[model samples]
Target: MKVTHNTAAGTFTLTGKMWSNTYPLDQLDAWLAFYRRQRDEHPKSGNSYDKGIAGLGRCRHSSRPRPADQLALRAEGQAGACVRVLGRWAEAVSRGKG
Candidate 1:
């Protein structure tokens, strides 16, 4: 997957499988904050936290995974990529590089 952050647009984009999706950075920031809180509250449930993040991404993007749906799987993977991208962006922002 290819991830890009556009500071001018305040957007994060993930591209793969000949498709791309863009999300508002502010929304992703909110999601990260909530995810961190959930992680802190339930530190032992790593899988649960991942599911929650994926679910939120799917919901926000109107992507519903279906059985035998490779495209859906690809989209889900892109969502995960988006999470990683946003994490890196957050770090950059904190370090004043964003």
Candidate 2:
């Protein structure tokens, strides 16, 4: 997955295999804020929180997971990459490097 923050457009675009989504900066900010609060409130449920933030979960609708879901599961721990990318973007913007 590749995430790019377009400052001029005020959006974050996430591109993945055969799928892509563009989200408003404020939307991402709200999600991150909510997740951070959830983590602080329930420290022991960090994994669940991360998965929630990453939009990752089990395939409950079928007996076998789809190929895409399997790929996501394999990329489990890498979910935080998106968050890290956002953080770096924020830092760069803050430092007048935008």
Candidate 3:
């Protein structure tokens, strides 16, 4: 996956294997800030997204977030889901599951 920021548009473009998505920078930043707060407040939990913070969960039409869930991209809460996807991808790589 690749992520690029467009300062002019104030958005982030996330390009994955066969799909791409654009999200408002403000929304993404807001969700990251929330994730940081959650991590700091619960250090023992180690920044787990499984609790569904900021509406992290399966998409309405599927059991999990996917490129096909374009509807979720319109929701502010789903901004965090993008971060969560990146987080999970990192974790999988670290564990040699990617």
> Top TM-score: which candidate number?
2
Encode model 2's per-residue lDDT on 3-80: one tens digit a residue: 555433456665667898788765665655676688789988756566544541121121122244443443335766
On lDDT, the leading prediction is 1
Residue 89 in candidate 2, Cα distance off native in Å:
15
What ranges in model 1 sit over 4 Å off? 1-4, 14-21, 46-98
Clash list (residue pairs), candidate 1: none
lDDT for each residue of candidate 1 in 5-62, tens digit (9 for 90 to 100): 5433457665666898788866765765687688779978756566546655654453
TM-score of each: 0.30, 0.32, 0.31
Q: Deviation in angstroms for 39 in model 3?
A: 13
The TM-score of candidate 3 is: 0.31
How accurate locally, in lDDT, is each candidate? 0.56, 0.51, 0.49
* lDDT score, candidate 2: 0.51
Error of 1 at 6 (Å): 1.8
When summed lDDT is taken over every stretch of 10 residues in candidate 2, the lowest stretch is: 56-65
> Judged by lDDT against the true structure, how good is candidate 3?
0.49
